[model samples]
Target: MMNNATVFTEFSLSGLKDITTKNRVILFSLTLLCYSVILLVNVALIMTIILDEKLHKPMYIFLCNLCINSLYGTAAFYPKFLFDILSDTHVISYIGCLLQVFIIYSYASCDFSVLTVMAYDRYVAICRPLEYHSVMTRHRVAFLVGFSRLVPLLCQAIVVTMTSKLTLCGSQIEKLYCDNWSILKLSCNSTTANNIVGFIVIFFYLGHNLFTMCSYVQLVKCALQSREGRKKFLQTCVPHLLCLLNATVALLFDLMYARYGSASVTQSVKNFMAVQFLMIPPILNPVVYGLKLTQVRYSLLNLCRCNKQVKGLN
Candidate 1:
């Protein structure tokens, strides 16, 4: 008899079961629409920031990095998801599964890290206006941005590395995409080390959230001191808070789905729970920034106007 627990070459994803061709077509169209919006807005914001010299400040720099990461994260999931929708098999190669886990998790981790850095940037600008330029120099901003991207990636690298060593007895993932927790569930070996490290990474980033929220609280308190501070907070700090809340809720949903979601729950809810992090934040962040942030909004408008003028000249 063949070994049932032998190393599997591929894993089947099981979320799209029992769907008809019509429904699959509808799902593909909607996913493509959403992914297109994600690309358009994120790329628009990223290009706006890159092209506009005046938007090169620390805050916008961080925001540009956020959009860039959104693109990176969504690219990992959406392309494969669309392909799976068109095919009979919802399976991923072992290496591809690990790579997806790394990109998706690291993307989530990178969001928090970027937000934490943005909070610090807001703190300096609002709490210490006089020292803003001196403190948030280009060099400092580059280092902070580098810090935000590097830490989560390295941390996720460790997690993915740990996950790759597991002796998986089964290969069917209960969710739509490959994730570390789901992969961990397949492992016949003990996951104590993986759990410890995963917890450490979770708490470490949760600390980032705590620091960011406390910073927001202090910012609000400072904003209440005067009218001008209040305006600045409304303009800048509020959007960051909204984004934080969005990210927190999405992350929490995924965490719950990964741990507590059951077959008893409807698949629609399960799909939403698994992918809220991927779906909502990428769209919301750029929209919020583009609409709310004066510089970005004006820059986008100017970009559009310039494109029109060039077209007219042609």
Candidate 2:
């Protein structure tokens, strides 16, 4: 980690503005539509889980938490991004940038934790079918939700502690937000300690999720041994597999391209990764689970029809 004197009070980001105006317009419109869909669907999901006690199980609880996290994750970065595109300015103050980074990390981390918890829920539901209810009780559900929320806060606290110690005396970040590596790169002093922290954070980020995925894999294998169980097991695992695959690819590209590529290349890579990371999970999640699992779709449709009837009566 290089520690530099804080020379810049604000930093400018040269995001996709260098592209053609026509392309920018197209992207802006698409982004607006996508954001609208994300907002509508996630809000509906949260409300459905909250209003219906029948859906108030550990699984749906985690699903609701995931939706909430995705909402925050999108809100943290997308508004500023849209503004930058429209105004032709990517400059952000130090404080706002820091807030953006913290929010992004917080939500992203929470989402990861919730996914792990969801995997565990699935495991118990499949592998230990008899004890699913006992193992994933209300208290356990509350604990999982609480744990997911707090872990991200703790991780961010550690990050803030480390970043606060750095002396940004001479340089400024080039990105739209105050990212870890971008800030570290701007440090005028040695960045060794910061690098170490980053590595540790990555380990924490990947370790829990990977372990959970492995457990699920084993559970899947066990479930597949029976001919009748094979189809149901595949249905249960495929959505999760798609989500994991999308997230992993996005994260890998975000890490590698941001570090090694040229500015233009980095932005391009991040632009695509941003869509995958920000949009695909939320969009595909409900679709995956809803379409793959008939019960959820039926519940959602029932809720929709109920709402419509109530509106008509009113």
The TM-score measured for candidate 2 stands at 0.90
Expressed as tens digits, the lDDT of each residue in 65-134 for candidate 1 is 9999999999999999999989988999999999999999999999999999999999998888899999
Q: lDDT at 66 for candidate 1? A: 97
Pairs clashing in candidate 1? Answer: none
lDDT against the true structure, each candidate = 0.93, 0.74
Off by over 4 Å in 2: 1-4, 17-21, 169-172, 262-267
Candidate 1: list runs displaced more than 4 Å: 1-4
What digit string (tens of lDDT, one per residue) describes model 2 on residues 1-314? Answer: 23324456676665554667787788779888888888888887888778878887887788888888889888977787777767765688777777776787777677778888888887887778789888998889999999999988788778866876667754345554556677776666787987787778778979967877797777878787776457657776677667666666666666665577565555665567544667777677766766775556677889999989999999
How many angstroms is residue 291 displaced in model 2 relative to the true structure, after the best TM-score fit?
A: 2.0
Q: Point to the candidate with the largest lDDT.
A: 1
